[model samples]
Target: MKFCLKHGRCNCVEFYQGDLAAQADAPYILEADYKTWLDVIAGKLQPIPAMVLGKIKVKKGSFSVLAQYVTASLAMIKAAQKVGIQ
Candidate 1:
């Protein structure tokens, strides 16, 4: 699955549930196991730590972009918490 958080908004702008090859191009592609994502959304794991711990994976993207979007990314995570994914 692919989730695109657009324009630095908390709301999910789009998502693709099929093979990534069929999805629209994105600057970043974050890949992780279900539990890893749950922990992130639940605030049990910070992204940096998770990355250091090898929980989260970036299949595509540039760290520079991620650094620039850090604030927006965190806000997006906080927004995801409202979805009750766990």
Candidate 2:
């Protein structure tokens, strides 16, 4: 999955297979405003709900396909929370 945080411009983060990178080709691309991403990473909001609520938009993939990896997705958020924004 690739996440593009839209803060005027888009800053992208990609999770492909088991690797994470600033940019990469991915089958799934999720996009949202910067604050929405911050909320997601902070655990203030959950990804699925955010998507259902339309706070997060899937720009390049299917939500049903992405939903199958809920555990991995949440794990990614947890991992991000651990590292935090420097």
Residue-level lDDT of model 2, residues 1-86, one tens digit each, is 45564433337664553223224665666777889989999999999999999999887679999888788778778878999975
**lDDT for each candidate structure:** 0.68, 0.76
Tens-digit lDDT track for model 1 on 1-86? 44555564334455654365345577777677778878888888887667656686666777556766567767768877987783
Runs off by more than 4 Å, candidate 2: 1-24
lDDT assessment of candidate 2: 0.76
Model 1 misplaced regions, further than 4 Å: 1-7, 10-12, 16-24
C-alpha TM-score for every candidate: 0.71, 0.71
Candidate 2: clashing residue pairs, number: 0
Model 2 reaches what TM-score against the true structure?
A: 0.71
Residue pairs in collision within model 2: none
